[model samples]
Target: MSYSWSTEEYSNHYSTDFDTIEECIKEAKDMGCKAGTTIWIGKVEEVDIRRVNLTSILEDLHNAVYDDVGEFAEDWYIEDIDSKEAYEKCENAINDLVVKYIEENGMKPTFAKVVDAELYVIK
Candidate 1:
């Protein structure tokens, strides 16, 4: 097979216009496609646990970094995060956890942002 597919969605529960970090993660953790795992199972054949966590963290980072602290962000993780310090907080959180996953896995961080991006395609 030379092709595959996946789906991504904005965490609507937190995102009035865009998904907040907490909401993105919460939804991914609960996705039916996650195969009962509390996170998105990115690929069915070989699931990447790190990407799963990123799905959650990235949304939060986008919201906190963008400065749109809209109402309705009163979710579990969101509530814990003080909006004033969210930028550094979320950044550090993802970097500490998800980024480490990629590093340990030998997967370069930038690969996710670009198509056909992989440290090496294991055939």
Candidate 2:
């Protein structure tokens, strides 16, 4: 596992293997990263495929499917069997797409993120 950081324009990018969150933060500060700069810490994935923004996909799904349901609405519950089924279907769809992508492009390391100084897995 590794960690990396990129600023708004991806300036002064820093990547290191097994760097603590404090260390990363210190580096970012030393490098003059702005206050709101996003410090992404994760492992490096080696893959032949182009990067796909899974976060965007998930966000789009949320806005389209889950955003409209109110708290007290009939569709608000996710623990229900129907909801669970739908969730599973969505999950399967994502898995299928990812698998197909990997099949076409070859395997690579999964995306990385930081979790309290620890490397977080994306897949």
Candidate 3:
């Protein structure tokens, strides 16, 4: 893995990669940054990318629909009580929905997966 550092004052520019965190910090101090100056250190690592399926996307939409409609029901009589089942029906029509979305938006839906990294601060 390679590591680099960036300071708040020069956030747009990141330092060149160093093999060790100690080398990164030494370079930062040599550059005249004071003791209290805030800096961010980042390390690059290889991550795996996986394809997401239509069923997973539809399930997320189903959960959102339930949160918006079912969760707020005030009484026995609620509006759009069948909204949750709409997702089940969507499994059959998902292809049509995707085609329509591509036709109207000129692009397919996209999703991203984020990986969290631990931050180490040097005083």
Candidate 4:
């Protein structure tokens, strides 16, 4: 797939400081944000789903997604599925998990995409 912008929306559950290499690397394992890998189009994704605290909210969403990043590492590798399939699956999984988390916390997913994995601004 050409990564066409679909109807799939975003909701920033939370944000953390992954600006540094170490931070990015650590977050890649701890929170799933990568340092160089462009997951979306530019920089990491940012939505509008708010919580009591940014850091804590992100941690909560991280917890709700999987037991931990280790368990989901294989899924992130994308060796099992093709490139396009991987993106679609990632989108579906993220949307499903993120949407569920927001709804459960009594919030709506209505944020914007700040950046993709490559750290580019689509907006």
lDDT of 4 by residue, 19-77 (tens): 44344444444544444443222233545543233335445565656565557743443
lDDT of each: 0.39, 0.52, 0.59, 0.43
Model 3 error, position 47 (Å): 11
Q: What is the C-alpha lDDT profile of model 1 across 24-72, one tens digit per residue? A: 3444444433533332112112333433343456567657755666544
TM-score of each: 0.23, 0.29, 0.37, 0.24
Per-residue lDDT of candidate 3, residues 1-123 (tens digit): 676777743354667767877787888888887776666666644332233344577456667777789865334332233566764566447666666766588664342222222344556
Task: Give the alpha carbon lDDT tens digit for every residue of 1-123 in model 2.
Answer: 455654422333436544455666677677776666666654443433444444466566555565576443444333334566676677667767887877778664554433333332222
Best by TM-score: 3
| Segments of candidate 2 deviating more than 4 angstroms | 8-14, 46-123
Steric clash pairs (candidate 2) = 41-113, 42-112, 42-113, 45-109, 46-108, 46-109
lDDT of 2: 0.52
lDDT for model 4, please.
Answer: 0.43
By how many angstroms RMSD does model 1 differ from the true structure? Answer: 19.1
| Residue runs of model 4 more than 4 Å from their true location after superposition | 1-82, 109-123
Which candidate, 1 or 2, would have the higher lDDT against the true structure? 2
Q: What order do you get sorting by lDDT, best first?
A: 3, 2, 4, 1
RMSD of 2: 12.2
